[model samples]
Target: MRHEELFYLLALQKVEGVGDIVAKKLISHCGTAENVFQTKAAQLKMIDGIGSMVLRNLKDKLVFEKAEAELRFIEKNNINWTYFGDEKYPERLKHCIDGPVLLFASGNINLNKKRIISIVGTRQITSHGTEFCKNLIAELAPLDPIIVSGFAYGVDIVAHQAALEHNLQTIGIVAHGLNQIYPKIHKRYVSKIEENGGFMTEFWSSSNPEKENFVKRNRIVAGISEATIVIESADKGGSLITANMANDYNRDVFAVPGRITDKFSQGCNNLIKTQKANLLTSAADVVYILNWNFETKAKPIQKQLFISLNNNEQKIYDYLQKTGKQLLDIIALECDFPIYKISSTLLDMELKGVIRPLPGKLFEAI
Candidate 1:
């Protein structure tokens, strides 16, 4: 969209009592939001359902100064802004009924990548939950996908961190504006994201991280992705909301099965049992279901000591090979090994020419 149109849309979004549908109607009638301001009050009456109150609200709230201020902030932060008509806008979300009129972006990856998956789960997670997130993300990384998630704690952070670990670009859909990151604790990872990936939101830069914004942001996460994965969620978890939104959008929904006794797994298990979500036992389950061609890109299996290990060692080796460079922390999590034993075993394997260690604590299979 043109800069003027974007300016209008941002203004329209902030207009009191003017919602998406109303803003859309106003745009349709006025030719442009700027035109809406130029048109006479009587001209606005020609459009159906646009009553006096809506008109008064539009006149009162359509502040160009506010929009210009937001644009200035966008410039100051070096953030990119996309209007609904921009090619860079998420194509999947463009068709949604309540899609945002303006989006704030800070990343290099295309939101419209060949494959996008939104990973969401409980903010409070168990070790099992975090492990599942790391393994699943690592498995999917080699397939060349753009990972999407809210920048919330727990699974969201795990998903983003894991994607970056594999050198894959990831996008975090924030509930608030670009001026600040929610929880503040994610600033470190969020900073990394701006470098390697991006952050996106419908709200303007000054918007606070309101509770409703998160529920609203889930739709964007759901709409933009080819699929949604719920790593671990309780009965009332917000991740379930994203899964449901994906289902509503006709995007694939996958749930990792968990023990019935665990509270966090209840949401996922319910989705699987009810057939609302496809059951996923491993990363291969997703790859096969989606038919992604990681195997075609697969490295040839070497018969050397590094490649000659049995199934378990080969599993670790495969991860190391695919990652090319990885931290011991990541390897232990991917292989689900005991942390205490992973370092000793990795060192022994390194000495035996099974793998090579690299600077900054990265490792690679020999």
Candidate 2:
């Protein structure tokens, strides 16, 4: 939240060759961006991912002007910005390694809620896909989970609008930053989302939507939810990418099986056949897997786990909430704590009824 910290984050994001892994290494070793700015080449070289290219870029400092410009633009547009550690950052998105370091928001959707599901599928959807998305989302409406989707044509748009029609909070994760809405036609719904919930993105306002950005963005959609549903996708559709990312994150991935011969159904069928996804005939399948009604059966202590946390504990707790499932290694890397320290701290926190450990050495906030 400090100006200097913002400067470092912006600078790090703008660095030409510094990806998430590299940024993690640099942030871990340097302590903070302010520290990184004062770091020497020899010290920066000690971090594994930083190479001569990164060293040169950091030394030259290309991110300052760009960051400042973005700040100014955000101010002008009256958009909300949330950094990773901010209280307002989406709880389900905070823990993923590829989670956006920063977010530009313009919607009414609450990213942190008891239930959120991302609905994704091919841009070219079929009549069946449209009906499937609409009816499924309508069924989900009574449960009131936050519905997320990229506002592309076909199923994506249908999913968001369906949630809106049902008076549920829905978020559209844009491929580009807040500079402009792709397809332009959905501009009408932008204010609708903001008035009801909101949209979010990782890229700076000025950065144009690139092909690769969509891939990077999908992880956010996948990472921030209890589950991901593929309404309809061809074998190569972007929705499949989000579903796969959900699997890697250990979140539920569901597919609505369609006619075996339909091209749009091929990806969903393959996912179900290969066991990459669970076959979901209806919204009830997802609610069952997530144990949505389990809270009603939970003891008082379990309910307390979600609400009662001291400030420091809440930072770690909220991080796990936004990001979902993460191994101690990744959590340590992102939180900038040594693995042993994080493990010990998490153990203590777990014993205190603040978090839950999942299989595969991952942790989640209650």
Candidate 3:
């Protein structure tokens, strides 16, 4: 968004009664954030849900000072942001009524045309939960899904680490500003994630990671993805909150089954028993239920939009698409397919209209 517009947007956010929903409504009717302030109070009051209290708040001079401070901080820190109406904003999140009006970030986050899912659970993740998460991401790696988390302890860290291990993009939805990292110890992982993905938040530089902020930000974790998975959680936890928000948004939610006696497993068991989430076993569960059929014929869009490839073909395709051209041996090693199996798989993929073999044992996605 442009500077003057962003300044008015920041100012609008500071208005006591003007929240994301109200701000968006006002901006939609007024055409721009500046217009909201410039429009006559009599005319603004005529808009639906525009009450006298909000009109009074909009005239507060204190909001402009706050907006100016935030704008200065944004300029000095070189923070990148996306407006709700901008194409750069997350597509799935835009569907959410309570989605942030403005999102600020640090790092190289690419949400365009990518599969995104949020994995959340207790801060105290167990060994079994950790192993299941690692295996799940490894199997799903071929699909090139963007893994998202809250960037807290336990399951969140494990999911981020597993994504990095597979060279998959991972995003950390932080509760506080990008000025500092929360839980401080997790600082070590920040640079690595920002290299491939990045951290995103709606909070301004003045905000901190307080309990209330986290509760409010939970919606971002719940609404920003295609699905939300609970790896492990106690009967009562933040992950459960995220799952509930996901359900409210009508997004699919998945929970792993575990021993009933385990404290962490209780949450997952309750979620399944209550029919709040689907029973998740393996990565195939996601594929089957989400209807990710790779063998299905593609629709004609000149370039054959949304080509569905099997896991092996997807792995090979992702590898070749990322690296341009690669030797068969490299593709096999990189995708973890055996040498004998890769050649046959590549041949099958070629016939299925996904990839092509280059000269000198090289391969590339078609």
Instruction: List ranges where model 3 is wrong by over 4 Å.
Output: 294-366
* lDDT (Cα atoms) of all candidates against the true structure: 0.79, 0.78, 0.88
At residue 63, what lDDT does model 1 achieve?
A: 70
- Candidate 3 per-residue lDDT, tens place, 1-366, comes to 489988999999999988999999999999999999999999998889999999999989999999999999999999999989999999888999999999999999999845789999999999999999999887677667899999999999999999999888999999999899998999999999999999999999999999988888889999999999999999998999999999999999999999989999999999999999999887767754575433323332223442566667777877887998899999899889898667657765654556656778787776
Off by over 4 Å in 2: 294-366
- TM-score for each predicted model, relative to the true structure: 0.78, 0.77, 0.81
Superposed by TM-score, candidate 1 places the C-alpha of residue 52 at a distance from the truth, in angstroms, of 3.2
**Model 1 per-residue lDDT tens digits across residues 1-366:** 466676777777767777766777787788787887778889888887788887787776537779888877877878888766668888988777777767778877565457888999999979988888898776666566888999899989989999988877899999988888788888888768877788888888777998898998999999888899999999887899999999888888999889899999999999999888999767766765675533223354456534456566667777887888899898999889888767656644543345666777688876
Best by lDDT: 3
**C-alpha lDDT (0 to 100) for residue 194 of candidate 3:** 92
Q: Which runs in model 1 stand beyond 4 Å of their true positions? A: 40-49, 295-300, 303-366
| lDDT tens per residue, model 2, 226-308 | 89999898877789889999999888999989888889999999999999999987665775567554222223345545556
Worst ten-residue run, lDDT, model 1? Answer: 292-301
Instruction: Give residue 112's error in model 3 in angstroms.
Output: 1.2
Question: For model 2, what is the alpha-carbon lDDT of residue 15?
Answer: 79
